[model samples]
Target: MKKKLRIGILFGGRSGEHEVSLLSAASILKAIDKKKYDVVPIGITREGRWVTADDAHALLTGSQPPENPRLAGDPEATPTAAVIKRGEAIIVPPVPAESLQPLELHAAAELSPARPALALDVVFPVLHGTFGEDGTIQGLFELADIAYVGSGVLGSAAGMDKAAMKKLFAAEGLPQTPYLAVLRSVWRGNPKAATKKIETALRYPLFVKPANLGSSVGISKVHDRSELAAAMDLAASFDRKLVIEQGVGGPGAKPRELEVAVLGNDSPEASVVGEIVPGSEFYDYEAKYLSDASVPIIPAKLTAAESKQIRQMAIEAFKACDCSGLARVDFLMEPAKGKTKPRIYLNEINTLPGFTSISMYPKLWQATGLPYKQLIDRLIQLAVERHREKHQTRFTRV
Candidate 1:
């Protein structure tokens, strides 16, 4: 019998999406076949504690870990300074006229490497938003020399930043709506100038979002000039850079939410399309997580031509961003106005989309022939294949 792959399922990040991450990890944990893989669950709390247990869900659901004191990088902004917040890294020497101690640091203890932990053949990160989705965890995976599912550092970073993703999409000739990026410095230093640029370039009813957070945590729809500043402020609080987009939906004019699942590395493939009808005012966090009213139409009832076009477009978007393993590419289409061409606008891609059975990514795959368990199996295979390919490259010269 082939040795069962030891897969580490990581979840519960320091992000606001911590709860969502727990939900995803639960679904993935349930779907992975025990006969084929040994799943080790790793949970990080919002307060930044890393732990693994038979009761992994408890840590996440409890928020004791909070994954609090999490360490993440934001290239757009530099870290102020490394301050020992907690744990053993926070050590202080004896202050016998040589040192003064603080409450956070103890004089007796010394920093030591965390006790050796079991190595993982592959890891599946169910974490979302911020530190989890924005390449920080992926970079850690690279440093550990382990194979993991989803995009690598570059792809994860690009996918997390809607502003950067849109620019790359435009450069690749992919049809996209006009959008502007608000740098942290610009928004903080010159609010008036930033507001003018947004107002002049785009009209009222704009979508303000944090460039690197996901799950619509810091997203607001601005209806007029009066609401613009506040909307931008809410978004900027979550990230150093913010993305402003022209709103597509209006009263009774529902923007069709279409999503396609892409899988594999290098030569990747796209699955059938799925459509989501927002249950609330829009597809906000509540509509997505809290309410169960949203509808997901599989293989989205569209003309053959429309389906094929979207599948191709999904692949194009994936390749444009150099995504690997998997991504859920979302779209918004203006309803066909009296038989005119349906205008499809690529929204954003989730590098590590939700994995719960109800989530669109796996559901699309399930409709396309790979069942839940098999889909998880295939992702593990893809991880191994990607890792093997990595070994072929020459890192150091002889």
Candidate 2:
């Protein structure tokens, strides 16, 4: 009999998007095919502490695990034992051990009975921001020589920082909005000088964002000099680097928000285009997660030529950032004026995008003929394939 693969779903991270990550993880836990896999739930607290399966499940669903979980095609099998304590931290050793070792840090002094280390065939990280999505965790996975989902270190890091992503896009000759990267120190040291530089280089109605954040957590829209100072202050509080982006479209017109999901490695494919109609003036954090008025249009209405151009640009943006596994490339299309065709500009690429059931990444793939479960399966397969390719490299002298 073929042994079922053990899959680890890692979630809850130290980031502004922590709650959003929890929602994404819950959707995956419910939708994943448990019949063909032994699903293990691993979670990290906001304080960066890793917890066991039962604790992780409880944290996610606010309920305890069943005394015995049903195995695939078996009703009379022996009960599976819990491997680690509920609150104990699970450490991924830098050395290649292929198992997550649990550090016993409980108050009790005695050691427990011998148990096998929790082995994972592959890790699906639903962590959405900072430490989890910004290449730190990917680096740890590389050190452990484990197969995991999403882009590698460089891609993840570049995708997380807006300044770096825009630079890469420019280097690839992809069309993008004008923007400036400002260090928090420089801005704070001379607010007048920073304001002058930004105003001189870009027009009003600019977007102020923390370069290293996702989910629009520290993003602000500024219309004039008075608004710029406050926006800079808000963005500077979140990150050391800030990105001021020029807005698209003319007066009183909003640019259309389009997104395309890219999947695979080496040779990647672009999904059907989707659009977001922001409930607010722009797609801020509140309008994205908290508001109920925002709407998502799958297979966004566009001319065949427009769709093809945006889709191709999405793939180009993905490759330019060296992304793998999956990414959602965003673009802004200026409002058509005086019978002229609208211009499309690549906004950014999200390496590890939102994975909630309703998130655009999965929805775009679904609209492109791939279901959510199948999408997860494909991502896991890609992770293993990439790991195998990495193993082929010669790290030492022959």
Q: Tens digit of lDDT per residue, candidate 2, span 1-398?
A: 88786778888877899888989999998999998777878776665655555668776875543333321211121112122111122432222343344322323323232322356778889989788788988886786677889999999999999999999999999999999999999999999999999989999889999999899998998987889999999999999999999999855679999999999999999999999999999999999999988899999999999999999999999999999999999999998788998899999999989999899999999999999999999999899899999999999998
Q: What Cα-based lDDT does every candidate model obtain?
A: 0.77, 0.83
Candidate 1: tens digits of C-alpha lDDT, residues 1-398: 78777788888877889888988898888778888876677776555545564335567466353232323222211211111111112212212232222224222233223422244688888889987888977876775567888899989999998988998888888887678998878998999999999889986678899998888898887778898888888988899899998866443566788999999899989999899988975688888889999888998988899888889989999988988999999988886678687788889888998888988889999999988888888888898898889889899998
Which portions of model 2 show Cα errors greater than 4 Å? 62-116
Worst 10 residues of 1 by lDDT: 79-88
The Cα error of candidate 2 at residue 356, in Å, is 1.0
Index of the highest-TM-score prediction: 2
lDDT score, candidate 1, position 164: 85
Worst 10 residues of 2 by lDDT: 70-79
TM-score of each: 0.85, 0.89
